[model samples]
Target: MEAPRLTTKTFHLQHGTSVYELHLKRLEADRVQLRGTKISNPEGSKALDEVEAHVQQRGNEIVLKTANGPHRAIAVRTARGVWVSLGERTAFFEFARKDVDAVSTQPVKTEIHAPMTGKIVDVRVKPNQKVGLGDILVIMEAMKMEFKLEAPMEALIESVGCEKGQLVDLGQLLVQLKTLDNKKA
Candidate 1:
């Protein structure tokens, strides 16, 4: 019998002023590898680096590991959008329908939520805090691993629904942002 076939997708990222394109291939047994290319010619030559990784589904928490390190990601299904975690260093990603591939198994939203029931290890933002699109909002500790929650959009925080050291449920509201009043003064 032939091995099961999986899908592949592409993504683009901008760090500072440089842009990169990433090609991701999903294999059987939950294996994924990514290769990145710099869009701008001045950045560098073309090269691809492969990482050995596997994904484990444990209820709400999806743990992904590569040879370099391991990442704990959270997913929350809301009426608005899907929230996903990139890794510990980066904030969560809030993705809308257009920003994600139709066939990808990952969530679409950039907003990071608790992957499992855990205590808030640290609250990085305060109520009414103005944050950028990828700012870190909170850090949660579960099963001795740390997960960072990030903003889905660039806006002023309307309210912080959770506090430091507070125990949060699986789908609890940790932070809320008010839409920017773009009207001129």
Candidate 2:
């Protein structure tokens, strides 16, 4: 007989400027448990009590049962990360393995893609616009939650492929960019 698999997955998630560390483990058939800690919170103190939840996915929605209550959420997997919407809060987390430095290991890219299949709520820039790192370039809404797509680095907007109220698919190209030093491109 084979021993039951015991696999734990670790993830680093970024919401706005806050980072969270989460560990997920299977607790039983069709059920999983998640334990998380906030690594940083921009509004105040950094310390947070560990959070625990029992999660299960049903179709495109995820149901998380916590000490508070049951909450429904939506999660979409993208090329570089995952887009998650819980209650009225939505976040696109830049995915990284435990062995990798999430910030330092990212390679510069010139395209901004839709992190989830949602409607574009707003577009903040146009062609030739110069944006700094962490600038909000677009806003999207999915499953009743709004998500802000921010600039990963300083760049010049080369093109805008989306507009206000436009529906976008996951991984769809929404904007093209030219790095600050290579703006001519």
Candidate 3:
């Protein structure tokens, strides 16, 4: 049997409007260049800037470097939707796995995983610990940089799968949490 395909559909900020489309492939492990076009803007205006970015994933933090400058971002999968933070600017965008054309080929879960292979310098929370939204959970050191893994929402820690001094592989689960009342159910 042939392998299935996974696709993510999202709206990117184009000027001032949301342009919706399906994101087909990831050009590299961290860099993704999608195949789609938007018509919600002016009749012939370009929907997006031609961007070339080098993305580095360190735990929950994402660093994107481009011609403009470097940007720090955080990604979290919440019950309501995906939350992405780029530097001091943050935005929330909702997406359904069913709306993602690639769901058949991808696995979905709530655990926060390491974005890249790294050494765990610190494990901040204990199992079953109560944490508020934006609490720092782990500290990962990679490529001479230190990254703090922050909580996406308020929650009680279900388990911490990794320990300090442990080497975690990319996409390895580091922590799990039970969503608290402050978060959308």
Candidate 4:
């Protein structure tokens, strides 16, 4: 069977202080092509040259086949962005909505959204529960992979918008929290 064609989408990915514009399209069910250009280059380092690579997903990992050879990485999609780990390096890349020309910075720190369409395997917090930064608030499963949504800051849960075993769409607000320091929710 032939794989379906996927539309190309542009995303702004940040690593350290540098940002890149990446256009991605699926060439096959397991093969993707990405073209990237460095959009912001700070001092003390060189800009990334234009790059094109064929990518494939292997379970929770991804392999990028470039002219320089193959590289492996793992990517986790979170409520605020995608966290990509390569070798000894990991970077959080805040994503622009697919096909959109704008960038999404960190959402209000008190809200936790569903990172992808998935079934909620666990809801780990309740209203009034205090959670610290990095606490796991929700556990979801998508495409047979589990994602642990962590607290972005110390906060008290204001509400739970989902339950265990419930399916949620990408970007759905799953939890609302009020910061512990008297900031806004």
Candidate 5:
């Protein structure tokens, strides 16, 4: 996790039922330290390992130092969490530490919205079709630029809301997806 400015803070990061306490401290500019411990270890259970890492920001890029090595990454402070990019992999972490407290608008979302004002050039998937990550589900064109919105995660296509030549506005619902858990519901 990273921010444009520096400060000392504590946070609770949660993904599913796992909650972790994250403490951030800056010893100096370009040197930020991290300490993490799980906050929900049950009695008589094996303890969750405590983790420590360092973050060094250089201009627009960041270097994450762990026991492994210094790895290059980009960390962007988002509305609800930090968006960290390590090469082709990216992850979003949710927290409301210190002055930033943005609740995630969707708890269990499966809908895909229009990323921008665009004309739907094609709708590729039908209901019940299974798609994996990075699979393109829709093709859009806006301002003469083409965009392929892909599956954010692996799921079954529940429905499609647009068709060829359909014009959609920003945030318009374009497709609905359902994972295995939702199917069991």
Candidate 6:
């Protein structure tokens, strides 16, 4: 048996519609540094910072000591992607390619995007379905908690962007709806 080798890797972390480019490398025994740059800010104003951290592995739990404080997390890697849980919250991430994801620069008012990364447990409405404000449109699961996302206003669902069991990123569009009064030709 030999000590595990550490190398540098970069990733694009998607939080909602925002994508962050992160560089990770191990510096010393159980110590590492993380640097991140925002790559999806259409505003063109991006600032990246570096953070020093220490990690302690205890069986299935890992504790990260950062400048802020010590936080515990659990990481699971599967064929689909990597799932990480911190406290009661969890986030899912996938590897990013050099080709940045193409996102619309226009502001969207009728689109409902995931507020956090999670698995789509269920979709309550279908395309063209009429829904009132407060109607639950989708249910997602993260860190053993289920969240029901509702309609912000009465609208007819123009399209559904997510299916059951789909992994969605934060700010990733899940549903597009139009006000009932906005009739399309």
Clashes of each: 10, 0, 2, 0, 0, 2
Predicted candidate 1 versus true structure: per-residue lDDT over 83-175, tens digit per residue: 566655443333323332322333234344566799999988887778887788889988898998888778777678788999998988788
Task: Report the lDDT tens digits of candidate 3 across residue range 1-185.
Answer: 44434444444322223333545454555665555544342343234444656788888788988788888899886665667888677777655333323432332234789978999999999997998878999999999899999888878898999999999999999999877653445
For model 2, the superposed segments whose C-alpha errors exceed 4 Å read 1-5, 41-48, 97-185
- Which of the two candidates, 1 or 4, achieves a greater lDDT against the reference? 4
Error of 3 at 93 (Å): 16
On TM-score, the leading prediction is 6
For all predicted structures, in order, the TM-scores are 0.39, 0.46, 0.44, 0.45, 0.44, 0.50
Among these predictions, the greatest lDDT belongs to 6
True lDDT of residue 81, candidate 4: 79
CA shift of 10, model 6, Å: 0.8
Candidate 5 lDDT (Cα, 0 to 1): 0.74
lDDT of 1 at 178: 59
lDDT of 2 by residue, 8-82 (tens): 787876655556677777655445667666544324324355556677787769888878999999999888788
* Per-model lDDT: 0.66, 0.79, 0.70, 0.78, 0.74, 0.81
Model 1, which residues run further than 4 Å from truth?
1-113, 181-185
Q: Write the per-residue lDDT of candidate 6 for residues 51-155, one digit (tens) a residue.
A: 989998876688999999999999876664567899888888765554554532423368899989999999999998999999999999988899999998998
Per-residue lDDT tens digits for candidate 4, residues 15-123, read 6555667777777666666766654322322344555677778776989888898899998887777888998998888854443223223335577899899999999
Candidate 1 deviates by what RMSD?
11.6
Candidate 5 residue-wise lDDT, 1-185, digit = tens: 55546577777665443455677766555666676555432321123444445776876578877787788998887677677789788776676343222222223568999999989998899999999988999999999999999998888999999998999999999999998566457
**What's the TM for model 5?**
0.44
* lDDT against true structure, model 3: 0.70
